[model samples]
Target chain A: MNLTLKVWRQSGPDDEGRLVRYEIEDVSPDMSFLEMLDVLNERLILAGDDPVAFDHDCREGICGMCSMMIDGVAHGPQKNTTTCQLHMRHYKDGDTIVIEPWRARPFPVVKDLVVDRSAFDRIIQAGGFISVPAGSAPDAHAMPVPKVDADDAFDAATCIGCGACVAACPNGSASLFTAAKITHLGLLPQGQPERGSRARAMVEQMDEEGFGGCTNTGECTAVCPKGIPLDTIARMNADYLRASRKSG
Target chain B: MTATIDRGKATEPVTQIPSRPRRSRRRVSSNSLKAVMAVSGAVLVLFLVLHMAGNLKIFAGAESFNGYAAWLREVGYPLLPHRGLLTLLEAGLVVAIAAHMYSAIVLARRAANARPVKYAAKVKSRADGYATRTMRWGGVIVFFFVIYHLLDMTFGVANPEGHEATPFDRMVAGFDPSRWYITVFYVISVVMVGLHLRHGLWSALQTLGLARRYPVLKASAAGLSALLTLGFLVVPLAITFGVVR
Candidate 1:
């Protein structure tokens, strides 16, 4: 299938960018969206043009590295699917696809279709993990966690640290991501020690990262590749309030 | 020794001042109105449920419905003083309505400003039903309806001659089976209100920090929406069926 691609082109973080149109012909309907982009890049290389730079690794969609806002939606038309997993069959022969980087203040455009998602890393680093001592392992039965609690924790743990929630959010808030991390760790007995501090620190880091607040529009869940529910956000909010009150 | 013993020791009482209650009021933030909307909407859902249950008295007979309305008015008016409990309740409702409106406007404005580019082609969903989509519009319509209801029922302003109605009478007359237009409008508007209340109630709780647990919060939100929608719908249906008259 032939498709018209209007992709954002930027030299660097400091460079002003614009939508540059390129027509790719004889594309296979079975080709992945990224593969089609690769075809475009190969043609660009042959034509003595700069190949469009995008972030991708483990193109199987587990890494969350392949990021693009295809025609405004995070990861294209399909719900809860990553960009790499999206196929050209979703579009028609003459469809014009608008490809751009994730638009969030925290996630700045490093280049075309690639935004810096390090802010998410910093937030996770602040207090997203349990400080388990390095050893062989703990006895699995020692904690004796209820089945319900274990299941809930598992649900919360599915967050892929993708910035899609931030991209999809109107406020550009990382509450969903932050909440997922907080809830996952805070639910277990091992996480009890730093639960309060973790919530406070993580939320502060998120705020410092310049992400916006959660408006409960539920768009994040709608677009989440991992299908991380928005309920984690409520938990995070509760934890944050408790932590702040205790410190205050 | 006697002179030394004569030396007197005097102690003074240290006066500890009571701290004044902190006078600082938390200014409404950008999300504050949303918070207010969420909280008040939840409370209003409770009120609506109770109200519908009370209106179910209409099923017993006209005497029962009219009696209930009369009882409410009497209890709210003459039985109480000029500044009474009912007055305070009415005042609270007004405040809740004002807060709900203010927050809604603020949120709508923010949402509008945030979307820099609107989609050329948007997919509409059944889950994202018409009532859900037109929440803001529904709110405006409901606001107007409330005003009209208050005028026609409470203050008795411009009561049409044929519809010489009390609050209960007005409700019954509005949903008269033959008056299809009125019934249709009532049903549609109430459904809109239900849809608004369904999400609005649970969202209010979430915003107010009550729904902190996962799944439970989400469930409550969904449950509240469903319950409120059902609760609000029953009254109009009952009236239309002549079960409430």
Candidate 2:
């Protein structure tokens, strides 16, 4: 398929970025979106031009490293599919695809379509884990995690830590991602020991990072590849409220 | 292989642990401020519901409508002084509105700061419905309308019948058939409020963590906002059409 690609290009972190158009032909319909970008970069390198730089790994979508806004929608027009998984067949001949990096203060553009997502790591560092001593694995039957709690935890755990939620949110809020991490642990019996502090610490860190507050728009979940429900945000709010009341 | 794995684990460097996580020392967290907005918005919604019901009394004629208005000022008359209860309620509403406005300004600024650079080709998701997009501007319109409404009905300043007129006279003259522009502005403002309430009610439920458990609150939010808006609109329409005059 012959297509027109308008991709964002930036020299560095402090440079002004602009969408540079590229015309490419002979693209296979079976190729993934990232594969098509690879072809473009290969051609650019052969032509002695600077190749477009983007973040991607695992090409299979679970790595959460692939981040780009395809024609404005995160991950592309396909629902529940990351950019790496989006195939070229979704487009037709003579189509013009406008690609850009995630736009959010917490996720600044490093260069081209690559944005720094270390803000997510900082939020996780604040408290996205259960406190456990390293030793032989505990007996499965000894813990006795209820089926429902385990199921809920697994559901929340499905978040891949992609910045799509922030990219998609009008407020550029990281609430959905923060809430997902909070819910993943807040539901388990093992997570109860420091649940209050965990909620307080992570939420404070999320705020300190200059991320916007959630307005319950559900845009983040609508574009979420894992389909994390908006209820996780409510759970986060519940936990935060409980923690605040106790602290008071 | 197991021994090698254990050896690797033994050689792993132990990272330094940070100090214990501190409790929230900030006077107000983000969600807490949102809760304040939600609670205050909920109070305003309740007041609107009651106000709509009172307006509906116009169908019973001027005597009944004016009497109800008089009773508002007469309640706890000897104990609390004339219009004392009404004054207290007005003061409470003012405080609620002030809190709501304060939170909105701060949160809007934070939202702006969160995305300093705008998306070049951003598209609105399906979930970002019309009501959601119009919230900020709709809120401003509602704020202005409330001031105009106070001058026209409560203060009797903008009423055609002047300040000496009875409550019913002021309301009737406010929406006289000849003054169709006022009625049009009233309709537009009321609809804006309805739109604001539609999104605000559901957003409030989410912030308060109620919608997650009762997902049905989303539908109730829409239904209640529509009902209250219709109730408020009926009185003005009735007066303008000479049905209640």
Candidate number of the best lDDT: 2
Q: What is the TM-score of each candidate against the true structure?
A: 0.75, 0.93
Candidate 2 overall Cα lDDT vs. reference? 0.88
DockQ score of the complex predicted as candidate 1: 0.07
lDDT of 2 at B4: 44
**Model 2 DockQ, alpha carbons vs. true complex:** 0.48
Computed on C-alphas against the true complex, the DockQ of each candidate is: 0.07, 0.48
Q: How would you encode candidate 2's per-residue C-alpha lDDT over A1-248 as one tens digit per residue?
A: 99999999998887998999999999999999999999999999999999999999898978899988988899999999999999999999999999999998888788899888878888899995677765889776987888988998999899998889999998899999999999899899788988988988888888877789888888999889888889899888888888888997
Candidate 1: residue B166 Cα off by (Å): 3.3
Q: What would the per-residue lDDT of candidate 1 be over residues B102-186, giving only the tens digit for each residue?
A: 8778666645543433333232231224444667888999888777666655665623323456566766766667765655766
All candidates: CA RMSD (Å): 14.9, 4.5
Which ranges of candidate 2 are over 4 A from the true structure?
A: B1-27, B213-215
